[model samples]
Target: MHLLIITREWPGYVLGGISHHICNLYNEVVDKGHEITVITGTCPQSSHELTGKKPPANEVHTVQFGYRKGYYVLFPIALRNYLQSFDFDPFDACITHTGVPFELPLPTVSKRHDCYEATKEYIRNGLSFLETIGDRLMGPFRTIVDRRSIAAADCLIYNSAVCRAGWESAYNITTPSIVSHNGIDTSVFYPDSGYNKEDYILFVGGSERKGLSHVISFARQTKEDVIIVGPDEVNSPHVDALGRLSSDELRQVYTNAAVTIHPAGWEAFGNVILESVACGTPVVATKNCGAVEVLPSSACVVTSEIERGVMKAKNLNSEDCIKAASKQTWDKPAQDMIDIVRSITNPEC
Candidate 1:
């Protein structure tokens, strides 16, 4: 099958988990002998240097766009016009991630990586008064775009059941959908015996929604070292800010940590938890996040008692940690996606 994938993020220029997810899926699908054409925003040179890997799409069309507020309004318009100008053979099916361009053909599947309403709520709760006001001013436009994108799709794919349910309840959406949890590359994230284990707690993610403040507060309470890795750095004495390590370095950090904590109040799916567990490191994650769907009870804990949760997780068997992560890989989800496309293109089969 020839697939046309439209997304704002891609590997070697990853903005978040969605970037990694799409890249992994692209590789898996291509391995199955399907041709993929990707239309995405220009990837920063720095990101390519950091990841040290080439972009995965068979054909890539990069558009120049800024990270400013109005880019959201402009990008879709530009994308739609660009797609309309294509003079080549028609694609078998279209698969979009996150944002969708307007008026795309049917059999196009829109994969919702996160719940927009839930994210807006997080911004409202986590931002300053001035920032909240700015967000409020932009709320209506964002809502319209989000609704139109979701409404335009022939089928919806969600990264987690929690994300799907929250979106349905918030938007009153009755669209047909499926939940296909995101997966990790076990080969890259697996535990390494050579890296000696450390005594620090690891927290990944730089955003306010990622529970950065919660991590700092937890760090202050604990006597052990706390390492925080992300785009931004914090100045707290309890925190060692390592801004964006490469995947190889991150895997080592995960393998050596005493415990990794994910305090995000909500996540479409927590890839960090899977990465941590795959490295044979136990994790203490918020009970409400998507990680809970795949994690065993022994690894989950409430946000309020993160310290206690860490202690409990430390006692969890390493084999169990790897076993749980092993169940989720790109292969199954990629196959499921192919099935969905087939059902649409060849209904009788």
Candidate 2:
């Protein structure tokens, strides 16, 4: 099957887990012998520099969409024009990884990695006064777009049950959806046998909703060093901000850290937790997030008990971490996607 994937974040332009998710799925689908084309947004980083790895799309067409707040409103319009101008045979299926395209000739499947409603809830609960006001002004428009996009799709795919529930609750509609968890690349993120682990704690995410403030507070109370890797630069006496690291470098950090922390109030799916476990590192994650779905109860703890969680994680066996991570890989989810697309094209099959 020839597949066309539309996403704002691709390899080299990775904004978060969604980028990695798309890239990994692209690689797996291609390896299975399907021709793939990607319509993605522009990013400043070159393909090679994105992750010290080349992008996997067989054909990539970039659009000039910026990553600012209101740019998504124009994405479907720009994408519609681009597709109209392109001359090609019909694609078997078009998968919108983030949101639905304004128009598409092929069977369209919308994949929801994050729900706008959940994001809005987070903003309302966590943002400053100014930010909250800004969200209020844009809320209606965003809601309209989000509803139309989801309703437009022939089928829906969600990264987690939390994401699906949030969308359904927000829109007051229950569309049939596939709940497929994101996977990790074991080859790149697996345990490093030679390097000795460190005593420092690690946190990877740029947003305040990712529980950065909570992690900082925990770091201040503990004597252990805290290393942060993300787009945001955090300034705290107890925290050392590395900004962002390549996949290889991040793998090393995960492998060496005593424990990784994910304090996010909510996540569609927490790739960081899986990545840390895949690297033979235990994680201390908050309850009520998507990580709870994949992580064992032993590894998950309430946010208030993060310090104690860290102590428990320290004694977790490295092998146990790897074993838990091994259950999730790109193969299953990629194949599941392929089957969904095929079923859409040939319902009798």
Candidate 3:
């Protein structure tokens, strides 16, 4: 089967959880004897100096669409024009991995990494009303576009039940959907990485929506040794800032730390939670994070009370955490996606 994948985040081109998800999914789908044609935007990693390792060789054919101007909302219009201008081969199915909605002539699946409704809510809480005035003004336009584009797709794939709930809650409608969680590269993020355990809290992401403020409060309250990578500088005595670490360095921290904290305000699926667990470190996450849904009861303490959760997670069984994380490789979700595509294109098995 020939599949069409449309996304902005491509391997080596963009850095994020979505990029990692799409890159691994593309590889997994290709390995199962399917040809993939990708349409992506230009977001180069070189601009940010993510130069530790070369991106894995992507075997699929890819085409990039250069938008004349900005606005992520313009992707649909640009993609429509790009397809109309070129003569492309018919694909059995098209999977769109984008925040905004997209439409395709072929059988299409909307793969949602995050939902905007809850995202906006979290953003508003983090910022002032004036800061969100622009979003408020553009809300109707975005909602209209989403209604037209996403409602027309044959199927929708959500990264987590939490994400799906948020999407549906905002729209007050339902669609043909499947909850296929993100996968982890167990080979790199595993227990026994030759790192001695240390008594400290670790917070990975540095975004406002990721609850950076919550982590800061936790650090100040507990006065525990906290190694983080978010803020440009650190003034606190308890917190040590490691600007940005390579994949190897990140894994080393995950293994050595007593616990990893993910106090996300509205995460679709917190990959860092699983990554920390895969490396034999327990996690402390809020219910707003989707990754907490699949974690074993023994692996993490799900609570916004970071101080208590972080302290309790330190005693969580490492073997239980690793056992749960080992099952989340990319191939399983890719195969499930293939099944959905085949079902859409060919009604009879």
Candidate 4:
């Protein structure tokens, strides 16, 4: 089957869980004997040519739309024309990884990464009424565009039950939705990485939405050695501030740390939770995180209650944690996605 994947970004081209998800899906789908072509946008500073590790010299081509860097919300005329002019021929199915050109004839699927209803909550953490109003006024335009794109799809794929619930509640469009969780590369995120175990808690920070403040507060109250690695280290004593480690480096952090922490109120699916468990590191995270689906009771202490999490982290069992993480891998979920795409295109099989 010929598949046209329309996404906002690609793996090496963009950074985030969404890109990781797309790369895994693309790799697995192409391996399973299907022609895959990816169409995505680029920043103003980015090279005009699409670049990434090619897969098996197969029939997969990437169509890059814009330059390297610019305002993320607006689309350039060139990008708009390039996207709108995409021919719906020679493809059995089309999947919009993010909002792009709205109209497509083939059996279309749009994966909803995060529901805007809940995302607004995170955005309005401590904003005043006027500030909140300003954000809300600006936010719904994007939401409308997303709604139009997903509403046009034959199927909508969600990463977690929480996100699915939010979509149902927010949009009232519940036609053929499925919860296909994200996958992790077990080979890379495994338990025995041979790194010196650091006697400190590790918190991978993101901006406000990721609840870095929560991690900082928890660390300060407990006075535990906490190393943070991500976009920013927001004022914490034990923070090492690695500031965006490579995938390999992340695995190292997972193996060496005493515990991995994720406190975000709204996460579609927390891949870090799975990475931590795969590295034989127990996670002290909120039950609300999408990783709760894959996380074993023995592997993680799932609660927002601070004392419970701290206590659980202090007494995590390594064998149990490793056992739990063993269930998740890149292969299974990747295959599941392939099956879904196949099912959409070939309903007879």
lDDT of 4 by residue, 1-349 (tens): 7777766666545634567677666777777787777666555443322246433323333445454322223432344567566676877887777764356777887777877677777778767898788677767666667667766788888888978877778776856878888877676688664567677888776656667788777766776777888855456564567788876788888889988888878888888888888888888877668888887778888888655785677687777877877776667766766677778887899
- Candidate 4 deviant stretches above 4 angstroms: 45-80, 124-135
Order of the predicted models by TM-score, top scorer first: 1, 3, 2, 4
lDDT of each: 0.78, 0.78, 0.77, 0.71
Alpha-carbon RMSD of each model: 2.5, 2.8, 3.0, 3.4
lDDT by residue for model 1 (161-253), tens: 888877887786766789888888898999886777788899999876777788889899989799998955696888999898878899999
Per-residue lDDT of model 3, residues 1-349, tens digit only: 8887777556555645566777677678877888777776553231233323323332333334454122346666556667776444567888878643555668888888887788877766655677578678878877876687677788888889999998888885566989999888887788664578998899998776888878877788886888897566666666788978767778888999999999988999988999999998999999989998888879989998998887788778889999989888888889989999999989888
Superposed by TM-score, candidate 1 places the C-alpha of residue 229 at a distance from the truth, in angstroms, of 1.6
Off by over 4 Å in 1: 12-14, 43-56, 66-68, 124-132, 298-304
Give residue 264's lDDT in candidate 3 (0 to 100): 89
Taking all chains together, each candidate's TM-score versus the true structure is 0.90, 0.88, 0.89, 0.87
